[model samples]
Target: MEDPNPCERAKKWLQSLQKIENMNKIDPREAPISLDSSNIYEGFVFRGLQIDQLQEGRALCTFKVPPRLVDGNGIWPARVIMSLVDNVCAAAIMTCDKPVKVSVDYNLSYFSTAKTHDEIEIDARVLGHKGGLSTVVVDMRNKITGQLVAQARQSMHNLGGLTVTPRSKM
Candidate 1:
């Protein structure tokens, strides 16, 4: 069963991210990133992602391709894969004591396809952080076969001083 309170869950997620930063001995001068639990779209997209490990500027997760995300051909679509890559990369970046950043550039390569219910291992690592920009590389592989499904390199920029307000439900 899902948690009844979204804010509570968000708090736990934030704590976990902070723990990773602390474990890595991140500079105390840097500000920690905050999660917006009210972002329902992100919540939906990241629904079943299970974090297997987290460290400073890196994250590992496991996921199973769900039926709802598969196309009529029983393969996961490119769009969904892109969404997963983007969000997972962001989560990995957040572990490094940085404020929320928006993707400014993205490059993705698809090597193989994942079918419905296929177990996948996702690994994301931040390559660098310079000024207000951060870059991350992500790889998705089939758990059993170890075949690469997709790889993504993403660049994100901090939206300095800008506060994002959640949209009101229609």
Candidate 2:
């Protein structure tokens, strides 16, 4: 059953994220990017997503596979998976409190396909860091059976000192 209290849900999610960050020794300043209506995560939220887990170099997002994102044969398309990879990779990087990065390269491999309305989980992690580049790996799976759906590797270029933030809080 779902928790009726938004506060309770937020608390549980925060605790999980905190535990993972502590275990991995991630920077305290890093935080999970929210699914604001104006953000890309809003797309996932519109499709019925739930943040299952998150931490430095790792994240677990669960959602019901929407038929609209699938092909005629009911197979989840590569494009959608690619977008997921990009977003999850960004989330993984967001755990570091570093400057925003832009994806320069993405290598994705598909192992299987998911059906419409399937409960699936996408897990992503920062695999390594070198100089101004970051490498991330992502995997999609069946939430119920833990079957692999797809795997992806993405590399992003850190903008570093070139990044610009809002002048003040909203």
TM-score of each: 0.73, 0.67
**lDDT (0-100) at residue 14 of candidate 2?**
33
Best candidate (score: TM-score): 1
Question: Could you tally the backbone clashes for each prediction?
Answer: 0, 0
Q: Report the C-alpha lDDT of model 2 over 1-170, residue by residue, as the tens digit.
A: 76334333333433433233222343446534433333333343334556776665676788688877788999777777776667667767766544447898999998888889888888888888888898988888898888998898999988765865659665
Predicted candidate 1 versus true structure: per-residue lDDT over 1-170, tens digit per residue: 96434323333563444232222444445524333342333444555777787777887888899887788999999988887788778777777766657899999999999999999999999999999999999999999999999999999999798877889999
Best by lDDT: 1
**Which ranges of candidate 1 are over 4 A from the true structure?**
1-38, 163-170
Alpha-carbon runs more than 4 Å astray in model 2: 1-46, 161-170
Clashes of 2: 0
